[model samples]
Target: MTSTLVENHFRIGKLPHIWCPGCGHGIIMRSIAVAIDELGYDKNDVCVVSGIGCSSRAPGYMDFNTLHTLHGRALAYATGVKMANPDLKVIVITGDGDCAAIGGNHLIHASRRNIDITTVVFNNNIYGMTGGQYSPTTPTGEKGTTAPFGNIDRNFDLCNLAKGAGATYVARSTAYHANMVKQQVKAALENKGFSFVEAVSICPTYYGRKNKKGDAVSMMEYLKNSTVNVKAADKLPKEKLEGKFLVGEFYKSEEPEYTEEYKKIIDSFQKER
Candidate 1:
């Protein structure tokens, strides 16, 4: 079944990707492909844009109109693509560092506009591709090559950031939860306004070794045991939910999408002219 999915959705020539053994990015990438395949979207009408990072390599393997853009600028390019041809389905594949750090301003504005684009953030905590630096989403006190003495910075709750910035749809899942990740990606794609999905992936090669968090399988197990459903989370007290994280759809609303609103203004101006 997995082989069939890869054969159907990936570019055959692009096999043998560079991700490390047991790295979760491959799983997340496959989940995205599964979601797109399940939606039965026309390849010609699908635009996969990505920034410079390990996760950004996803668009290269995908069978779509793909753009491997500058570091931290995937969202900017995707916004232009969606605005230029509103009919196209634009999906931005970004990493935690690429999106939440360097391209953070773009993220905020895009969500505020409620642009009709689906953004998938692969949050592996550390910057896996760039020598294992601590990223904006890296957990506090977690050790990275850049933080050998343990990091003191606070991590970003990306789901909350998207929701607060006015994104109409937002969800989160881990690479270990393959089916849930696929479903979340599908829901993001179907939403008309801006949608954000955070896939908490594992970087066993770097993050695990540096932090002594065991191997890939153990990290995946941690994800499974540490996450609670948002619905169930609400019933728990703040202290009880201290160490655990919330997963599942965090927010959804039927707001007016930016492109549609722009079209209305253009139509009005044309009538006056």
Candidate 2:
């Protein structure tokens, strides 16, 4: 693939990223950059926000107004930024643990309010940063440092969570599908209200070794083969979808953006006065 499109967008001095060799986070980050490029968004008009985790490190390389916030607090910071300056194109880069666990309440409310910010959750299913702990999206029976015996806890379907919570756009893609990731992210960016894209990523160093899922290549291939498009999944029998997940845009709707609604309220108050 050509680097021309994303080359200028990144800080070349930060060339060697801290992510593990073969980690999918890098691919996801590149996909986001590609989406931004395709959408013709001016770098100055974009703000990238992230929470603590491996996935959150993306903002360090991207040459944009970036915020590295507290763990699971990316949404809160992004919310504040967008509310204060609705003209900025706010995009959030978060991890499964950061978005679905401690930051989950923020995720729900952000979607509930239909805030004008696009979120991309790197769903690696395990916390690769602070140690290889199983996160909320960890598949049942998956092994991690904290779940050496295999996790029995139910996993959260992030896309469904966002859609159900009222996000105007919701989609899912995997790192293996780089082009699809870019497309989904671009679509999310174009949504007026809250938009979410879940990028299923691979953590080869920790999650892979702990679970014996083979190398990063194998894990990526698993994501490619194990997931069906949402349309195809609908036609499949329940038994066929037992071990497979669905990808592609699952939901979308028109809604009043939170910032826009807030502005209307302020305007009404001024008129009343």
Candidate 3:
């Protein structure tokens, strides 16, 4: 039987998601749901948006105001939703390819605007839903169907990109660190301006098989061993940190949110009238 949390937050009929066995997207999705539940936000006041990709399917299963929009347009639609109804808590669930490839422009602009929306990127490195193509976040030299000779492009550190683009809150966590993902997501949702959380996930069917990354268990174990918390990383020696990625909050600051600023202009015009 599904837990009460799942029953409450997820569509009961949508149980048994379609993700491949060992895919880490489910864990990331669960983390998002848990974060929302913990925050006690009324489901009707929450809007979940998603673009086309493996991870984009999340909003379909979630029991909330949802928009399964066009590929790479999740953020655009989310921005409109927030502007139209500032009272709604908007959260976007996007995949690496969906957000960082065709949707990259939207991602940067949303961060730049410091809009009041939370974005959770389920980054599985490769384009799992689109035939295992190399994505913007696929590491250099990683194998993908399109890059069987090995991907030569440099990968993006999404957190860095969001921070540079002016996101008020930025953080990263792997699906292996379920609790950390939940914590970061909770913090991101609570922030009043643009927020981003990268949930590094595994694609056992595609990325794993193509890259010879073993099974789901091996990929999960790799995540457990290859990441360090930002706080602990600060205390560890450089040598100890080599080859390990830093997880946890990287940047956060209060900012004038775009919606709020826009409202100020509207109120001024109304007073003038």
The local distance difference test score of each candidate is: 0.93, 0.93, 0.96
Pairs of colliding residues, candidate 2: none
Q: 113 in model 3: Cα distance from truth in Å?
A: 0.5
* Model 3, C-alpha of 21: deviation from truth (Å): 0.2
Go through the candidates in order and give the clash count of each: 0, 0, 0
lDDT for each residue of candidate 2 in 92-120, tens digit (9 for 90 to 100): 99999999999999999999999999999
lDDT string for model 1 (1-273, tens) is 348878878887887899999999999999999899999998898999999999999999998899999999999999999999999999999999999999999899999999999999999998999899999998899999999999999999999999999999999999988899999999999999999999999999999999999999899999999999898998998888888998999999999999999999999999998
Candidate that scores best on TM-score = 3
| Candidate 2 weakest lDDT stretch, 10 residues | 1-10
Return the candidate ranking by lDDT, descending.
3, 2, 1
lDDT tens digits by residue: candidate 3, 172-219: 999999999999999999999999999999999999999999999999
TM-score of structure candidate 2: 0.97
TM-score of 1: 0.96
Q: Report how far residue 237 has shifted in candidate 1, in Å.
A: 5.3
Off by over 4 Å in 3: none
